[model samples]
Target: MIPTDWIYGLIGGVMIGAAAAMFLLINGRIMGASGLLGGIIDGTGKANMKERLAFIAGLIGVPAIVYFTIGAPATNVSNNMLVLLVAGLAVGVGTRMANGCTSGHGVCGISRFSVRGIAATLIYLLAGGVTMLVLRHGLGVI
Candidate 1:
């Protein structure tokens, strides 16, 4: 039998793809979460505040709904506040540097055969693998 984690991953992938497709089809724009949030923060998304808010709401609300409905699975991630804060800040900085996050460059961008997206995705994947290898195995920090 397939592992439960694989099943969960598949379901999550489908949901993400569906949501991205819907956002693109309905709004005629790529669904980059960072881009959306950045717009809101800088007042550039004033023209589509409702749309951005709805997208943000879904990002937060869906996970919450799932947690309330079926309980959350054990993530096995570090609970250290410092580690989490650093990781979050790193991700934010990385996303800004890359112009998008995994959902954008890795999913939507790659799906559309964008050169920048593909390049960014490859770089981020490589960096993540190297970081995990170093931090988790080499230094045992994570």
Candidate 2:
């Protein structure tokens, strides 16, 4: 049977694609999150730094806004804070090594019909699946 998460993910993908397409069409810029955030932090995307800051603020604050406004559903952490930190660091390292994150490759790259994007997307998916399998099933981390 199809998982509900898959349906949500498909919808999310369509929304992200639409947003990226619109951003590119209007701004002539690729909607890569890391680049945007980095540009803002480094004062590089300054022609629209105000707008960029607003966008980055929205990105970071939206989840908390939603949680506060709509209420947060409880989450049980199977791993400790240290594990979460390590995992985040690993993901950061992986993204740097790949030159982009899944969103950059899967949405922006694919939308532009880039072969590199396609290859990166496949690698991202395979790596994520394998990592999850290793963590949950093999290493019994979760």
Among all candidates shown, the one with the greatest TM-score: 1
Q: Point out where model 1 deviates above 4 Å.
A: none
lDDT of 2 by residue, 1-142 (tens): 8999899889978888887787788877777786676666557777888767776787779878989899865777545888799877887667666767776887788877999989998988898899889988999875
lDDT of each: 0.90, 0.78
- Model 1, span 1-142: residue lDDT tens: 9999899899989988998998889888788988888788778889999989988998899889999999987779888999999999998777877789988998999999999999999999999999999999999989
Q: Which residue pairs clash in candidate 1?
A: none
For all candidates, the clash counts are: 0, 0
Error of model 2, residue 32, in angstroms: 1.6
Compute each candidate's TM-score over C-alphas.
0.89, 0.75
Error of 1 at 83 (Å): 1.2
Global CA lDDT computed for model 2: 0.78
